[model samples]
Target: MIHQSFLDLDYCARVSGCETCRTFRRAFILEQITGRDVEFLTNPDLQSPVYAVLRIESSGDRLLLTSTPTQKPSFAATVALNHEPRHLANDPTKSGARLTTDFQELRRVVRDCHDNHECSSRYRWSRRNPTWLLEIMDNNQVRLVRGPKSLVDYVVLSYSWGDPAEMPAAEWARIKGAGTKTRNGIPVPERLNPFSAWDLPETMRDAIDITKELGFGYLWVDNVCIPKGTNWDTEASLMHEVYGNAAFTLVASSSSKATDRMIKERLAWSHRSKAVKLRGKWLHNTQMPLDKIRLESPVARRSWTLQEERLSPRVLYWTEQRWYWSCPESQVAELEELGHVRPENKSMERRSPQLFLELCRTGDIEQLHEEWLDIVEAYTPRDLVEPRDRFLAIAGLAVRFYSAKSEAGGSFISEEYLAGLWRDNFARHLAWSVAKGANSRHNLQHIAPSWSWASLPLRMETKTKHAFKPSEHFRFISVVEEKEDSEKAMTGPNFTSHDSLSRGRTMEERGRGVKVVDVEGRFRRFVSDNAKQVSWDAIEWRRGKRVGFDFGAFPGHDLFARHEADGRIIAKDAHSGEIVGQLDYVVPDEALKSPFTPYVPCGGEKEIMCLELGESAMLLLVRNPSWGHQESYRRVGVAISYENRKGFFYGCETRTVRLA
Candidate 1:
């Protein structure tokens, strides 16, 4: 009979070579079960503990036994001895026997029998697909088995254990050792691909030896040599590498020069459009007080907050080539992706005739020597020509040369864009001269040549005294410098004011056949006999105020409005104080002996001429004008000073009038 604990290693070790194994052997034989049983083995010399194994019979009934005796070998002490002799009569360890023991040991015996059969070499079909090829015993390790050859590849057992994929590709290659990939016989160096544009400057240096010598490494211009077919995404990704990496950019200012010539040709092909019709257009009067006209409306300066291309001309150099009047960097990236190369080597690039004419006078004579000869050949000096004329003529040529390039398919930058770029770049210069206040604005006039206008009339010589002057038709607004040195301060006003009360007019051309009407009331305003209102007294000009006048007496009368005949009027602020000063407008006629003659007096007459003016668009002091004391006008309401000599008086000139 078999014991319930027959397969237990410790229990088997106590029984294998002892009387229990002999008893089990006899019992299994009596039952005639398949297989022989094996005894347990122990290494006595190695001092290793014991484990059990089985010896199978010819029919495969396995006999489990221990090599050592349990409790020093006593047949009567065996677990099977407790069963009665009758239990042994049926051979209880066997399923068909009448004698019975626990089912647990019996099931193990059956399972082991099946396992031995399946793993047996004679069962060759099992080799077709092995089951225990890989074994994950637990989280600590994995065991890969190939039958009896159980090999465990422990990743943690090796030194190189962390994630290798996270390492840089270059580092990976280095660790892997350098090797060349052969296409046919040609060997290509193995490398982790880098962005192409990052290497553009280096490529250019290798290609153009001359550029490499000219400090081109810092600002390489590749547009001339690099094909525009490169992918844009790659180019855009390399923007910081291209622009930020470079010291400065080279711009090709001549692209539009050729284009301008083409434009002229196109204009020639098409009929000319009619000139725009504008009324009441006349030259500004020199006799008009600067303080009065100082408040006149001016055309707005150009706006460039979000300009994509430079309005003014700027150059960028790269790749031994030059990109003239280049578009903004943001736009350039898009173009670069389109495969258009930027230009470079601008110091040697071809100059358009117009650009040569314009910028030729800007540099030193020695630096401009090459262009000097060309200028001398193109234009001859006129009689009594000012130095400015000579400079302008040379500058004109340069401008035309550059402009013509733009007219072609070149990247012609807009003049406005160029101007704005120059201004932003030279903002420090502006900050430097903000002092001298309004007079400092005059300093900006020299840079005016940068703003080239195609519509301005050009002539070789002027027949009139003012012939050499800027266009009289277009009033070039400038700040009139006041005696107050407030402009010298660092934080002084960026603007200037011409005070009518502090100065008076002095001009030789105050025409006769004109009558002046002082429109100074609680709201001080000024108007002429046949002209509109010109000046507004900030204090006197208020909402719901009116000044009426008569114009029927004058003949061939064209009213010269000083402030408001045709323009709209609206009170800018509320009125609350005593009417100390007034703003007035008048309709003056040329028939009057002198336009300066005042039609209103402060103390002499209670019926003073008052022409109510508009405050809708009047240019006022950058700061609110606060004349300390509120009092009656001394001589004439307030004197309109002519101040500077330019030309004719209009709706916004200053005039002197008596204040009561």
Candidate 2:
């Protein structure tokens, strides 16, 4: 017997698996698993929409699964109804109506996670004194005064700085004049008066409002927190600790510009697909996926915020539609209706801060490689207001990762930092490429070595399938670059890891390449077809190569892709005439050096320069003897060749090609 009709349904969105949805959807889900397709959903003549909202009268959090009376959902079909009301009469005041970032709900969510979660406590680090902090409630930037308060629990803000040039002249001038502003390229750090809240940007003011509402006294806004100086490079070193030790971070995900408001009116309905009703009621609104909600934002696309997001143990993300709080174990919202549905881990790498940190703590070396690759994918493809900060932006993360593994009881103590690539199976990280259809370019500032992904600005291809193995276990993988360890705190590297390089050589075969360790104990990367022996351009190889390359129209040199893309570029062996191996990226022709054809070994015509940090394809060689770094190469693009052990760069002399 059915006790409930599951009426009063709304917001049947793409990512909106709301509370009512789960219970109402249970009937449709079960029927599909055991019965036939839902007729109302598939009926052609109806041309009407179906919407459901589940209502349960239970004392406990869970539904009444086993009861004296059995219950299930009931569905009814009906036609469209126009003039649906959004109920925009009263002031929202961040209420349950729009799933606002209201304080009462935020407090409840925070209290619940703290009281019930284990990971919340374990994910924290020992508290430390913040370098410099903003008094959110007050309009002052002050250091620790003569008081017993040494360790302060501060809230941090992560937001897009927007284009400095376009900022209000008064605000930008005040910021620069306040102290050495990082964005305005102020190279000199000097003693200056503290800036008032009135001088700060709108986002910062909003963040301050949020911090104050959360009952925090001190706030850390990058530009304001750091003492005014061009020498901030040294001060930047403590960023990891600054964020790691914060009480929590407020991320303005929806704001693309500093002037834009973080909190805005919510869009509850869709205009794209017309609203048809079920049982002559309930409107339709597709749910946005959690990943899109987190990543598809202006702040998410900025490179510098990566460190801020990853290091903070707890974060309150303000997306376009609603507010979400994420900790080690859970990502919850303030919507009261959401209380009906239990949120489960979707296994999104960036969704959980502890995902990679846990790997470091447990000394999971093999898993760390894949996680780092994901970080690279997420970091690159983002637009940097000042490209010079490329390496500097991610330097904190590199330092944090290294520090984690080098702790007293950690693994890979021998792991060395070579530019952005790790020392272990250093060859595997060498395989990187712009996402298919994306483009790559040299960092005019030349912030990193040619061999390092830091040397370029490009969107790295995001890898979904796990093909990563312990590089120690691989035989053909390899680099030695004299890297500048996190400059006090930053760098300029745009890099990413592609799919698992072709299956590793047999245990014995992996060691086929030469091994030369100088005093540094670094492995030599075999140089493939160094100037003379290039066979990629050979007529035989060209004849065997067939093109399925989609390098022109992929999703905008994007970073942090959905689990949707797997672009394949295949290479063939003229001898076998068989579709043999995969190539991750091909530098387009415009970047190719003279005398080199697309078939000659690099990206096809339009031949853009590239670098290969090989796990999969053989890509661009980025080196310039002219820069005075002998035998050093700049990566034009990253590529890896798999399956065919003797592909383009196969069987070559092992040499350490320091990428610029």
Candidate 3:
């Protein structure tokens, strides 16, 4: 590309003719800033490639800029100008951030987020301090800050733990020792007499150095402060507070592991254009897109970091591409203009910090669970290092959720946490199953109740998006008897219901938008039996009427209808060759639908039971419980009937069964 001055660039474009002006014109018009379109808006026609934006300056620089080309024009396209060039740093290595305009505007955006955004202030500063904080001293020696409040503001580091086996023996020993020493408690401001930035991991070293440069006295790098093998019981539970209260979080996104550097490398981006020298000054372009900021980096894929980013008041990230600041309102990329983004393009999950407060204020339980399902959709798919961490990894986020739901002097919902799910929404919450194309596995340790998603290294799907249908399928089963759960818990025994069962007595009831009672591990999924096979002991049929087919639900997980309605496997009764129920697989594999004989390893054909969730949705519970939990049952799959079967679920086996 030829270098052209800012003013002359438009002239050359007009003289040479325009290529994307039509698209740019339509996009610019959407901004509603200018009434008419112009022949030459700027020297380079930077049509939006991802989301659209047209820059119009607010300062003395009455200049206009453009974005790369996009698929089609958008309603959100806006006319805006890039901020001062000071925000884009000439040297990333020296600045330790992306889009480092020497951090001139960076500080302002940070201040605006901290001082102005209430969502940021309310949840943040709630935790007085983390168990320990590393104080950067004038001599460059890092001192530990623990107990009580010595510092009001500090930065927290969110990075990857990486593969410990790859680390050196000596360094690994130090990391393990750090956890043990801290657990027993350490002296105040214990100066690690020999500790220096050089003695730390590359990511930690950069974080500490950058914290110093940012003029903060303390930085909380987990590897050094908390370390590997530390009993999370002490620090893990305080995650929401630790990250939330911090002045800001410094994310080492580019660094894959502790050994990787956080200074970042930009040599790969040199080939592309970013700036052109005009009158001995660089007229820079806003190149970073909104989607590129949070969704792409490797750190975003880690389970703990997802909660870290969601809980933090403000996050300052150093990805391989650029540095950006994310808060409740919007994300500010260093090189781009302030908030050069289309609000619609921002990820809702990323807005969790602010959304958390708003959800709590509304005091609505259903909406909160929906938000949780959204979190599960995103969080469960990401990788987990320790299978048991399914709950702990999200413990911080769960705390916020529990606190939000339980805000008004506690509720039946908040106090009851069975595995990773809330008791009140257990029915609707049970609509998750392994998403298609996801190679998920059940944990050998059963770290979670078999009824919870936490039991597996989750990659799940739910019926809300797919929308389960109950009317079209259920054949109507009768509950032979009704009795209090006689199986006494070591103490009090109670009833937990599907989020949809409040008005389930009527045939017209679609199981949504109803009052809920706290329940957990009451039911699970149903499995289909190809033959006229029926677990006679599992089902108590009403006099002349046969119980309908519940051939789809299986144990250990849940799934959706719309998500995978492509097709289903036909489940038939083994004895009569009767078409009973159908099993919906997450993926529409031809083989699955071809012969819907979903076998229960080493066991013969069997039928399952269903618990009504909403009008159309019923959780399928295989009558068989695992590992001799005879009085209890495990979940399998969820069943949705398109046709109304309000009467179908009536006359069902009403017994006090436990979910083990």
C-alpha RMSD for every candidate:
42.8, 13.7, 13.3
Q: Cα lDDT of all candidates, in order? A: 0.22, 0.47, 0.50
TM agreement with the true structure for every prediction = 0.17, 0.62, 0.63
Worst lDDT run of 10 residues, candidate 2, spans: 499-508
Q: Alpha-carbon error at 150 in model 3, in Å?
A: 5.2
Count of backbone collisions within predicted model 2: 70
CA shift of 556, model 2, Å: 39
lDDT of 2 at 509: 16
* Tens-digit per-residue lDDT, 59-118, candidate 3: 423224233334333223322233334333443424332332355656677777766777
Instruction: Order the numbered candidates by TM-score, best leading.
Output: 3, 2, 1
Ranking by lDDT: 3, 2, 1
Best by TM-score: 3
Stretch of 10 with least lDDT, candidate 3: 504-513
